[model samples]
Target: MNMNRTVLYKAALPIVMVLICAPYKVNAYNIEDAIKAVQLNNNGIKASKENVNIAKTERAQAYTTLLPSINLSNANTRTTYDVPQVLPNSSSGDRRSTSLEVYQALFEGGASLFRIDAAKHHLKAVQSDHQSQVQEIVFKAMEAYERLVVIKTVYDFHVKNEEAMQQHLNGVEARFKVGEATVTEVAQARASFEIAKANKNVSSGEITALEASYESITGEKAPQNMDPVDISGVYIPSSLDELMQICLKDNASIVALSSSIESARGNTRVAYSGLAPKVIGAINVNATNIKRNSPYKQDGTTYMIKVNMPLFNQGGIEYVKIKEAKHRERKQKAALESQKSAIISAAVGIWTKYSSSHSTIASMAEAVKASEIALKGTIEESKVGTKTITDVLEAETKHLDTKIKHTQAIQEQLLAVFQMHQIMGTNLSMFTNTRPIVQTAFNKS
Candidate 1:
């Protein structure tokens, strides 16, 4: 039995060794996943969804105005003395009655229809608003994700720089001991090393803060491994004019304002309805007994057609309301135009930044390459006693700065593209294939 157990242990030894030695594959968290998480967990998105529901309920209530109203009532009364009854063949005594009535509006100058239209348009406006809010939150998440990546890159650069500086300081100290370097040179190298160390620490702190921010936005702990963002799949129009046209047509904020204008116009029509005559039709069925003890009862059915003409309101309030509604409609129109202009301006600015950053990346990349070559050459020259340590240190610093700037330029370009998506109201659909959370009944066009 002991021999069999030894043989079993030996058989499993290779498998255990492989398991311990092999690298574990960590799944990379990506921008698409981050966006999906934020959409599901964000409080702002949940609130916006609630607003859409409220608008839907308001729209349903508006449609109910066109339907008939019904009421049923019953009453019982007693008197000390006998009372005469108005209806024929009714005894004089206590009375009990029950009524069923229904009222329907036949016409009010299309006021009911106008109210329905207004509600419909208002629903569209809120839906657009919700879309806009979603885009804003998405942009924020992208911003945070990109910023975290850049900071991480910067932190890595700082760590490398610190290592390089430490090596240089060690060489300087060795040279000083050999009577080949001065005390001032040694101090300078030490100072540069300290600076690099401080920068690394600062970047490390930024990473912690950014990770917390990511958690706050996504309601998930930030992943240790994150895939680099890929912006190549995102599409952008070449010409500024074409992009602007798209923005005007598809931007959620602009769409919302346009819907608001239409809603306001509908409300104005509803206010004008107050000047027209209103027609209503009502039906009533009632049963009454004048004496509770008596078996005799009277039943009646009544039909009514009522018309109310506005000769003059009590204080000309209808006319004032009409004027106020018109003013509100005009205000909405003005606001729409202003929003359009603002969106155009923003589009132009982001386009400019994207163009600049796109060009800057190429130039900065070349600068980094040149700085690397220069630093190498300077270090070689200093080793032969032809160049000073100061020159080598300067080149090293320049190379590091160039690398950082190149990273920043790349981040800026990516962010500008995302901002364009935000302006075009397409960010929500850019990365995912899921259906929209809020939908409106009206056609987008």
Candidate 2:
């Protein structure tokens, strides 16, 4: 008992240590997060995993095609009538006998090898498809994450503007009550205030919708006050050709298509592999008892070996080869077309936006600077009775518009960067490299 206890303890110690030493980690699973959740949880991936298991089982089954098969039989007979012998009348004798038979495959038309190879190729195809599905999910997550970030930033901007406008309105209302301001100015301030509030509501709704989509993909609630990405320092490709090259090399769709082409080629190999002859050998043992309706007695044993060759298959094999070849051709063509389309679309969209947004940003920055100077001049002139209250209000409004536009320009640039990244799969590494700020926030408690 003591020895058994010691053995059990020794057996369990390693398992306990392994469990304790495992890594404890969590991720925000945002746009930057690895899209493992989607792949790990997606129904498609589950099916792919099952297909891999099925392939293994099929390989085992294929091996059995060469193994020997056995059969056993026993029978008892009793004669009730006499039979005539060669010399005179004679009685028939009762007899009981048991026979064992075995058959083994000695050769085949390479059917087993073809079956195994086909199953293996299918397994590889499913694995490639699983990887493709993973890439697709990651792209989707990136899209959702970026949309949420855009909405949050825009909403915050509107909320800040609303607060500032509310304060200005309050001040203007007090001045009007003291006969220091016109009713028209007060009404104008009120109108601007209402517009800001409406914009804030709309932006907030957009944020909520984006948040819901993010959560649905991740199966987790998002953190509050999630900060937008800081892509100000991201490198932009210089030209359309440069962008196209990167996308061709990195795009998930392109990668998936490439993998599929390989898989189709593998299928073609499997189909043609059937043309080769198969050789196999097997041993079998069969036993039977010479007892009537009894399971207690020992029996005789027999062994056998056999071989089979296919001369004609009624065109079944030929049909399969032709079908596989055609399917492979179709897959190859489809992959080529898909890669071409993705590259062209990414190149045009990113290049056009990259150029336009850069110009817009420069122009917006200048406009904001000019608006600042104009607002200051208008305020000075109004104090000296050279400008009316309307002129000052108009200047302030223009400055605000320019500031907002500049913010929008920055947003457009960030969005453009994300779009470029989507075209290039390597951009996902940015999310992988950057640690979420919320990690420390949560750890502090």
Candidate 3:
């Protein structure tokens, strides 16, 4: 029974120890925070939101064309008649009129229907534009957040290196007093320590600036030491063709450009409709009264229906020159194609950088392992006076340098990978725990 217990203890001890020494993990920033920091805070999103409201109001106005428009007016007039200038029963005539007139659209060569169609498309375009703004702000905020993490990591490493160099300088000074090291060695150590200090100061300043910029973008204080992503495994694209397809379908830039093109097309149709004839059926009731101070009065009322249509337009040349109507349509289509091409190019570049950075990180990892071994050997030899203080310092410097380089390479690789995912317009939920905010700006309309 004792032997069995011992075997069990031996088996579990290694596992327990590994668990205790594991690096502390942290939660990633959620997408909700990003949405609040970006979509809510961004000026572009605010403008787009207003545009959505305007589009909805415009659509409501267009619908009114199908209904009757009514107007009410009241007026009073008094005039003294000229002496017989023309059969003046214009007897110091006083007149008062009150009337209401209304018109209902019955038909107009399909123009009204086309206008309604155009308005609906215009509203859809506005909605798409608003979403585009939200996406853009989210992207910018994420980039700034990631950049801040990289800066903080690099700054922390520099601080550690400075402390390590200071310790080496102190040891070298002690050795010099003991006649084991020369003043020249002490001076060299001091100089290296100073340079390390300078580098640390520069890193600290850079971190401060980056933190400020990050705060500005988020409209909130930057979180301390956010957990950096631990990316592993090389990305192997299925094929370039697949990537192209993804961009064509999911790229927000292209989607926005296409929306613009559709909106422009609708506007062009509306402009051309102006050349067509318009007709409306109408009925109006009106009454006028003429009064005399001696208590005489005259009154009349009338009811009528009327229709009006355009016969000729002298403005055809000007209408044809409304370049905006056509240019906007063509420009948006061209821009959509250009955006797709640019996204494809960017994805290819990011993938290549990810590949190169992956290899660099691997090579630096090996270098760090070698340096660690060398550092250990030099420290063991230093106690026996075989390894001089300068030699130990050199080995320490090289080891620290390799460690920093390795960390940097890791950071670059993670950023490149994220960038590639960004280009593909992957869902934010994949990397974050929170979801995007609900947009209800046009819910009522």
Best by lDDT: 1
TM-score of 3: 0.78
Question: All candidates' lDDT scores?
Answer: 0.87, 0.65, 0.70
Q: What would the per-residue lDDT of candidate 2 be over residues 141-231, giving only the tens digit for each residue?
A: 6566666766666677778778867876887799899997799989888887898899889988887787787767655555654445665
Q: What is the TM-score of each candidate against the true structure?
A: 0.89, 0.68, 0.78
For residues 1-445, write the lDDT of model 3, one tens digit per residue.
9999999999999999999998996865643465467655666667779999999998888787778888888899997876677764556868888877777767665556666777787787677656555655665677677677777776777788789789888988898899877889889889878988897898888888877876666676677746554444323346566656666666555666776677677777767666556566655566777776554554444444455555556755537634668887788788878888898898788767876896898899999999999998998898897887777778878987898788878767766655655565553324442322121121114
Tens digits of per-residue lDDT for model 1 on 29-60? Answer: 87878898889898999999999999999899
The local distance difference test score of model 3 is 0.70
The per-prediction tally of clashing pairs is 0, 2, 0
Q: Which residue pairs show collisions in model 3?
A: none
Ranking by TM-score: 1, 3, 2
lDDT value for model 2: 0.65
C-alpha lDDT (0 to 100) for residue 93 of candidate 2: 43
RMSD of each: 5.0, 11.9, 9.3
